[model samples]
Target: MATIPAKYFIALVPEGKIQEEATALKEEMKNLFNLKYALKSPAHITIKMPFEWNENKEDKLIYKLQKFLAGIGVFDLKFRDFDRFGRRVIFVDVLPSATLQSLQESLGKFCKLELNLINELSDRAFHPHLTISFKDVKPKNFDLYWKHIQSKHFNADYQVRDVALLKRMEGRWKVIHRFPLTEA
Candidate 1:
């Protein structure tokens, strides 16, 4: 029998205080989303998402990551507030900033040119966000969920020093590599 393929997601994880606030926010989201399972650790702003890859491909992916990250430098990021996306997904919207927009666009291009992962779910044109809660919620519950989430607010900010490669294994996500975005 063929094994179920593992998935990998790359993200820019916030360090220190912001990480803590985001963690707390996850609790709020869990309740609002009426989640069935526990949330994952290392709350972050994703740059790339679930892609099929083998364990042996780590080094090559890292190399590609390094090359793509070259010329790109560290930038600040702020997790402004919580907002639900059509009731199915919950995310913290990031306030627009040029640094953030450039980074997202560049990464989107690199993911296309280097990794060849197609399927653009979001605008690479705008700054991206950190997903706090997601579930396959029933349509009837959508308004109930959004109304609950509407009253809550999340305001956390942090400098984005590094981005990471996270791989899912044995039913959990693990950070495989963290590449720093150096000062220009």
Candidate 2:
């Protein structure tokens, strides 16, 4: 018999209304630009980037995450307008926040020390944004997409009450568990 490892990542995923809004934007991106890669996962600001871990050890991983995350205080996030990573990516712009940075840094350190999950992606500066489009958008059409997206408006205030651990299941990502934020 053989076992398949599960691909996992942690993120602060807001509730229904925000997800619906983000999903709609993602759908619009696919329709307008013929790029659908962002549709693979729900809109989220990544806390711990994807890592491979043995499925048999998942319970242990979840337990540690639960313990670590429950001590963190819940915080509010403000997102206003749209921004891009050069021409390659367009996202719902997140306002500058110190609390968000602290949460991510704490989670990153915990993942490294406790879960032994080291992600090269996380090594980069933490920029929190709910992506609307990335990678699949053709370079030539970038200006067009940017022009189109700029015409669209997205702004919201969301509270982070819990963090989700998602597994890359089947073909797309699915939330397997949520660890709530508790004031320390």
Which candidate number maximizes TM-score? 2
TM-score of each: 0.82, 0.94
Clashing pairs in 2: none
Which run of 10 residues does model 2 get worst, by summed lDDT? 116-125
Report the Cα lDDT for candidate 2: 0.87
RMSD of each: 3.2, 1.6
Per-residue CA lDDT of candidate 1, range 1-184, in tens?
3444557877887767777776676776566565533266467777765788655666777899888877677777666766656657767788777886677777777888788776467534344776666665566777776676567777766677788888876677778788888875
Residue lDDT tens for model 2, 12-117: 8878888999999999989877889999999998878889988988898899988887778888899898999987889998998899888888888887888777
> For candidate 1, what is the lDDT?
0.71
Give the distance in Å from residue 177's predicted Cα in candidate 2 to where it truly belongs: 0.5
Q: Estimate the TM-score for candidate 2.
A: 0.94
- Quick one: RMSD of model 1? 3.2
Model 1 clash number: 0
RMSD of 2: 1.6
